[model samples]
Target: MRSRWGKARRVSTLEGPAFMNELQRAVASMGPRVLLFLTEEKTVNTVSELRASLPVSVLIRLPEHQRLMELMHKQGFQELAEAMAAPVPRTVRLQSSQDLPLVRGLNYPCVLKPSEKNYEYGARFKKAYKVGSAHEVDALYRKIEPVLADMVVQEWIEGADGDIYFCLQYIGGQGEVVSSFSGRKIRSWPPRIGGTASCTAAWEHAQELSDTTASFFRQVGFTGMGSMEYKRDARDGLFYMVEPTVGRTDFQEEVATVNGCNIPLAAYCHEMGQALPAMSPVSPQRVWRDEQADRWSREVSGEAVNAAALTGFPVVDAQWRWHDPLPWLDDISRRAADRIKSKFHK
Candidate 1:
């Protein structure tokens, strides 16, 4: 397979043109069969360019909800939800800000999201914001006027905490789940009470989580590596199925691979209907820390690129990296400068 850069044009906090150029050089020399696209920092147009260059498989996280559903229809993803028998949040499409009050009767702490973003790629919501009256709802609408025009208001499940429990599966062309891994999220940064995790562990607990995820994949007949997330119900101890993240969990890929499960390479073989290696019995107890450590070295500091060579703790194969390093580095830098400021205060 030929390797071409995906999403090379868009610029972000990371993976800009300069970064994409670096990625292209690194992958070009390595000779990958496909480009594993990260849509957050790049555009879907980049994927189009790559597929033009080689036989490729591309999966992207959509930045809006409507786009996600549309892509689901195109990529056979919607069928999975239908098959899983999963109950989804009640969604009302908004033509403009006018639709807010009509939907607000459902009331207080509802989820506001774009009708689509290909799939959960860019679903944003102010979870737990109470709107006891229409007045509060209107306030929110006015506050969110800039982005709310294109978004929707949906019935929010009181139990949904967004501590997503993820099930990673290697699926065959026949839609059978060949192997799987379970993980639980602990903390997150965006501080969006229900945002992405700051840390997670490959721990196993609920079997229903696996069964539900498996059924969803079987229905879609997905023939590649995929992940599904569930929001845990703290009271009943069950998870509400959120969405199926098709093809690779940017960070979980490392967790699974390091814990003796190689979903990336395994999914490729499964897609071709080739014989797959047995799933290794990797202990779920394994813990992986991000390789980059931020501190005041008093020396010219830079983020570490090579996580593979970091010694001491058990590092999962190809899973550990400084994918999001700058923000953390900035915090450390500020704290270090504060220490200097303290001495001067004396």
Candidate 2:
């Protein structure tokens, strides 16, 4: 799909019965010069299947059936942060469902999220829940037993959407911070008490988060794409580290593509030791606004939206691509129509 700017070209979707088959097509579609890095909530045999297809890198957040939340605190990610003198949240790992009772003695309304390689979508499968009281925690654990063992309970910081931060990190071959971009999330859904962003803006803050994150990336000898998320405390005004994702943060590659810097393309070029193409720095304050007015209208009662927060900007909203949405809409619409038909027939 081509955007109005005509610079961004959407690729065809690849769905396959086998992970290797999918990888083959992905590599072919992208061409031999491109690099593909694979990361997934669950293991896809894509890495091993496409080992020879092209130069590919794979990072695993968690192994199959391994409790992901438990690995976060134990993994060297936080230790690497401390060694780099980065500010990270005070986290306590739970060994059992019984450990949740200890949180009551600590702080109220603590943030509870999986430390593993999980995202918003995975919450449904794990039945991820956040609560204020000890009772709620216990009840949630009881409701979703084995999965809670890997989760973490940390003190929650209060802040508006502006407090959330995501940085696209690129490390050079010699483990130097080549470039990084900071973006502020404007709005989100599951309403996670945050959902996804309705809009995001390029931003700047104290170098604390950046400096520390660079140090850790350098220490890890990381040579590819990573996104670091943080939340600034409303009370003390300190930025607490949330997660340093090893892979591409969702929407990041697309955002970079639209704005002019293509990290994936850069990564492929860099891996080949080729001089990267001259990249034009995107103007500060680039906006990514969701245009799903119909969805928003369902909540509000009119076509005109009262979204003063996201009014004027060069934005990419949740508008569908007519070129590719047909397959997806067909499946959904067919299911809905079948359900209606069955109800009427009965």
What TM-score would each prediction reach against the true structure?
0.59, 0.70
Candidate RMSDs in Å, in order, are 9.3, 6.2
**Residue 159 alpha-carbon offset, candidate 1, angstroms:** 4.8
Q: Which stretches of candidate 2 lie over 4 Å from their true place?
A: 1-34, 43-76, 117-128, 206-209, 278-284, 292-312, 318-346
- Candidate 1 local lDDT, 1-346, one digit each (tens): 1113223343333333445454455455545354354433133333323333323232322223333333333122333354446645444555566776577556456555444342232344453243455566567666655644555555555552235577877665456677777765433222223333323344555366667777765654454556776667555665766556554344545565666667666655654457876667454334343322211111113324222232223343222236645545666677799999999999
lDDT of each: 0.49, 0.54
User: Model 1, poorest ten-residue lDDT window?
Assistant: 291-300
What's the number of clashes in each of the models?
A: 18, 9
Q: Candidate 1: misplaced stretches above 4 Å?
A: 1-84, 115-135, 159-163, 198-206, 268-278, 281-284, 287-346
lDDT (10s digit) by residue, model 2, range 1-346: 2234323333343222355554455455554454545444232233333334433442322122122222233334566566667777655556577677676775767666554544443665432355787777677666554643566666666786557776676666576655565666655443334444454545456255557567766665555556677788888987777776654345544555555656666665666777775556566445564544224532543324423434454565444456656544655677699999999999
- Winning candidate number (lDDT): 2
Q: How high is the lDDT of residue 157 in model 1?
A: 52
